[model samples]
Target: MDSHVFQAVAAAAAALLLFLTYHSLAFVAGKKLPKGTRLPPGPPGKPFVGNLFDIPPEHSWLKFKQWSDLYGPLFRLNIAGRENYVVSSEKIANDLLRERGNLYSSREQLPAAAELLGDNLRPLFLPYGSLWRRTRKLMHQLTMPSAATTYQPTQVLESTRLLDDLIRAPQDYQKWFARYSSSVIFRLGFGKTMQDEDVLRRIMDVNHSLERVASPGSYLVDTFPSLMHLPDALAPFKRELKQLHEAELGLFRELLDDVKKQMDQNVAPHCWERTFIEQQESYDLTTDQGAYVIGTLFEAGSGTTTAALQSFVLAMVHHPEWMSKIQQEVDEVVGTSRLPEFEDMPSLPTVRAVIKETMRWRPVTAGGLPHQLVKDDVYNGFFLPAGTNIHPNQWAIHREPSLYPDPEVFNPDRWLDPSFPTFKEPLTVHPNIQNYSCFGFGRRICPGQNIAERSLNILVARIAWACDISKAKDEHGNYVDVPLYDYVSGFNTHPKPFQFYLKARSPHHAIIVRSALEKETQSDPLAGK
Candidate 1:
């Protein structure tokens, strides 16, 4: 054949190959969806790789909201070949997350997390099965309402340290808040005070690292799960995950070993780990089971509680007038000499509103951990296919103008409507805050919510009573502008670092703060002894 004939033949062969590939993809797409079933509206994109590249490098939540508006309340996005449905309305979220909760409780498998970091042991990622049930029950026993009262002293002591730290070095509010969270959990989980040198720092470091890796945007390996099967050397994230895994494991083991040693020596203070380990046989828990159960409790309870408290501080600093109002309420209820206690929680309406507003303003997990559907379901005639991941967009729901008027402004009054009935009102769910989505929704809601709320309530009340929190200003004495939206982009949207001012409300409050630190003996676990 001539050279021109050979070139023509090669061009024809290339065209045929492209046609085959397109036809194959078309066949797959056809089989993927049922006939006459319309997928939720979403950003238009290329075949088999829909809208994956459209997601922003940062503030993905903001991007998601814009897409949800352009599309409908229920919108779909394919990220790295996996399908995700962002539920933007409270009603839709309720139908899927609450009404059909059993089928929608399992988390999407994060391969990097499951294999590399989690050991498939973390409660948050546990499949919705017997294993998850057992683990959750254990957490509930330890953190539910009855159990929360037992943990009150730990909350008080830690918040005392927080108030003192804020008064002493207001500039380091972020670090102090992190430290407070670390210390609070340390006492509850390990029966050790974080006042031990560098203890809070070490714990905070581990938690911060875990937070970074656990978030949705942490690693490409999570987005493209096929990469998980690749060897450690070839995958860059594998090496990074290994380091994080080691750091996390080391810290967890050290705390566990300390608790074990204390138990062995009969010097163990009453802590979650010590209590559980002591009764492991009665609970039918294997040593590994006990370790993981306790570990999950430590991880889930600590990170979320810390994030909430940090958000509260950030909110108060940004909205000083609200802080003042809450402080006034605290003064009327509890007064200056005595710090507010857990018992005051129900009585202090303003304190409760502040807590609710903080959660509303910036929920810790704005786009909650995605729940994977186990079965095909239809809501209001909209088909929800199995294997689709669902995330309730709390940011959009809370900011809905119809649900919360003037949503941007920090106003707690919205919650205090006298005629606003409790659970009796169809519009309101969890009116007593017992089952607020802040903890989460349905059967898979956070088990540690009671303990967390008790801790938050006591801390916020006492902090407001003893200290005056305000924003730091520029050298010109002008109010320092704080980016209210300056949030660390992550699965859990905690406030990013910001400067703030916290001073004792009065000389009497200053005395209380100083005395609380120095006279730690009053808070000494062995006070009676």
Candidate 2:
């Protein structure tokens, strides 16, 4: 053949190959529904890449909320041909994630989340099966409400340090919150307190990586898992994920090794790690499984607790009236002679209300972790296929105008109002309820809710009792502007670090805060002796 003919043939072959590759990249298993069945209403999409570009990479809950507003509470999105069903109402979420939990409790196996970052060992990403059940059982054994009291001394001790940190360097309040939250989780996971900021940074780094990888539409490979079959030389994302996996494994293993050493010396404090290890055989958990279980708990516990504390500060700075009311309630119940304790919780209804309001106002997990369906189901005449991703969007659910009047405002009075449909005891409510929706729902509801609430309650109560959280002032003595809705985007959202003025309420309060810290430093209160 002539040179011109050969070139034309080669070019045509390349064009055909490209077409096939593009078509293959968007392939997804088609769901065949029963006759006359229909999916929930959602925005229209194009062929092969349905709603692919429609899904935003960051702050998707906002987009989801907008869709819910337009398409009713239940809606469907077909992204890259994958089906995602979002639930925006408390009633629908409760009916599915709670009432029919067994059919909706499984998790999707995202490549970055389950295979690379966590080696399929993290319980949070585990599917609804024996492994998930075992891990959850182990978690319940350590974090049930009955088990929560055992960790109060640790929480109180760490919270005292948080109060001191606020008094010393109010501007770095975010770091103080992170430190306190991580310290508690570290002690719980490893039987040792986090001594340096480096560990917390490392933990945050892992969390950030996971958030990006696990989030829907973050990576093409996650959507079209066939891409994972590509060789390492061709897949750059996998290489990066491999590095993250190694780093996370190293950190978790080092922590576990330290706990094992302590256990060998019989000096290990009673903690989740020690307890899990001793009972591992009964749970049929491998060493790696045990380590990842504890590590994922730290991941789930620390970032959320830190985010909640940061939001609490924002709420107080934005709505000082509620803060004052809480402070007055705290003063009357506990006084300045001693910091507020767990036993004072019932008498300090305002403090409890503040905690509940903070969670509702600025949920850390705006869109709760996605739950996959185990079987095809119909709800109110709409067909939901098995393996659909279900997102119980807390942002939309919490802000439902019917349930919460003026939902955007930071008001705690709703909880106290008899006419309001608030959970009677927010702290004791099941995770599926409206008040506890921040934690999540169904079989996958956060097992650590009890301890997390305990931590938030103690810290919020103490901060209310001892400090005045207000907006910072400029050189001209004008209040510095703080946006009420400035938050970092992730699976676990947090107030983007902002300036706030946190001062001890009085010199006596300052002295008390310092004294408690000094005493805690001199002795290990977390030893639970």
Say which candidate scores most in TM-score: 2
- For model 2, residues 179-233, the per-residue Cα lDDT tens digits are 8888888887777777756777788898788777777667777777766766575
Q: In candidate 2, which residue ranges exceed 4 Å CA deviation?
A: 1-32, 423-435, 525-529
Clashing pairs in 2: none
Q: In model 1, which regions exceed 4 Å deviation? A: 1-28, 32-37, 197-199, 282-286, 419-432, 517-520, 526-529
TM-score of each: 0.88, 0.92
Tens digits of per-residue lDDT, candidate 1, 1-529, equal 5788767765765565446445544643554655556778788767644566788766677777787778878998866456689988777888888888889998877877766776676677877888788777677777778778877777777788788878888777767776776666667777876666665666666656666777776786676565555546456788877776777667677778888997789888888888778776667665555666676666666777777877888788777788888888888888777788777776787787778778877888887778899887766655677778898877776777767778788777777765432213322222245677666777788777777777777888888898877788789998877777777776766777777777787888878877876677575874432
Q: What lDDT does the true structure give each of the candidates? A: 0.73, 0.83
> Each candidate: how many clashes?
0, 0
Name the lDDT value of residue 141 in candidate 2: 91
Model 2 per-residue lDDT at 20? 47
